[model samples]
Target: MSAATDRTATLYRMVMPQHTCPFGLKAKALLEREGYTVDDHWLKTREETDAFKAENGVRTTPQTFIAGERVGGYDDLRRHFGKPVADPKAVTYKPVIAIFAMAALMALAASWAAFGTLAPVRAGEWFIAIAMCLLAVQKLRDVESFSNMFLGYDLLAQRWVPYAYVYPFAEAAAGVLMISGALMWVSIPLAFVIGTIGAVSVFKAVYVDKRELKCACVGGDSNVPLGFVSLTENLMMVAMAIWMLRYVF
Candidate 1:
């Protein structure tokens, strides 16, 4: 590669006390990380920034130029390097994994406080309850979004529609009741019914139909895959319902 093409890039970034642009800092860091010698240009004043934008016929700061061609901003720079830029609408397990991690931690803490020990059985109960509640909270954030995503794979929701709306509330109610060890009659049945439906639906969608899709178990907005994690969630609920049923009956 030629020395100029191999080593250099031009970066224009905003650097002011009141309006220091974060993307500008990220762009500089990215360039350095990727071993590029950056010709760093700072827009120190608002007028200077405005003038730069007008001159370039662009409206955003922290613009990059490689080989004297405008490469836009931070996200654009990432693309230029073939890095994965996060898409907000994309499906991912990040949200679901985060909730499960937090739920387990909360369960451990609660178990310790209540039992003065991590009682294995009780810890399992607490973990499932907290996980259910946390997942329900995500779904409740935007029920309509959750329902729409849910209908894509959920058998009952696709047919009944209203079941999608009711699912979150039922999950939350079952979770809360299980936590308190109260109203097993209500919680057990609720858990069993939903868990059965969800398990069957997920099995058919992924294993039977061979359709790849997002799981609404975490929330409508999540990118959690419709597979093992989802199946496990349903199975946990089903097991909890049966376990709790033994106590009630």
Candidate 2:
């Protein structure tokens, strides 16, 4: 094939009434982005799709062909163009980092709006409170999953399974009350109790026992490794509890 002919490619993808293949659309877009002229073909019926798959010796749709050479699916096309493929099992701190960064910004914004300036102490308090609320939201999304994961390293949760279910709610309640500067009696004690337990659990599990595990702080489905980040979360809670204690007396 000539160099110009090589720039032209053929794509066969599923586009049925009930379901259009998402990867097929992605593959076409990628080919276009890479400056390829796609001769797009659609397998409109199940029989046609099955026939095509059998003919091509393949099991999936959204197949690409360049200069009579089959290039597989969307991921294959990406690799052909030297792009990185996503791995679902990859460990990452992105979720926790995003939560913490957003919390910091929100805290500053709230401080400015309420006090007419970015009050450092107030922002700091709000930062921790907002972080807790956000983290709780993650766990609350899948309470059962969070509880199951929490039972892995949390001493209290391991002993009393019910605490696993209650932990997120307690964290959220403490955060909300701390933010409002109301009911320190409830929030302070709750934060302190949970925080102390969490810190000890994390330290013993990671530092002393040295067992590798995934953190449930972000959520049960998280890839964040159980370590300093989880420890920091508990420490922050404990610190916030102590700071808020001044108001109780």
Best by lDDT: 2
- Model 1 lDDT tens row, 1-249: 698676789999999878889999999999999999999999999999999999999999899998878889999999999999998877677877898899889998998999899888888898999999999999999999999999999999899999999999999999999999988889999999999999999999999999999999877877788999999999999999998977876
lDDT of 1 at 135: 92
- List candidate 1 segments past 4 Å from native: 1-51, 64-72, 76-84, 87-90
In model 2, the Cα lDDT at residue 158 comes to 94
The backbone clash count of each candidate, in order, is 2, 0
Q: Write the per-residue lDDT of candidate 2 for residues 11-71, one digit (tens) a residue.
A: 9999999989999999999999999999999999999999999999999999999989999
Candidate 2 has its poorest 10 consecutive residues by lDDT at 1-10
- What's the lDDT for candidate 1? 0.92
Error of 2 at 163 (Å): 0.6
Each candidate structure's TM-score, on Cα atoms with residue i matched to residue i, is 0.78, 0.92
- Model 1 clash pairs? 91-223, 92-223
Flag regions of model 2 displaced more than 4 Å: none
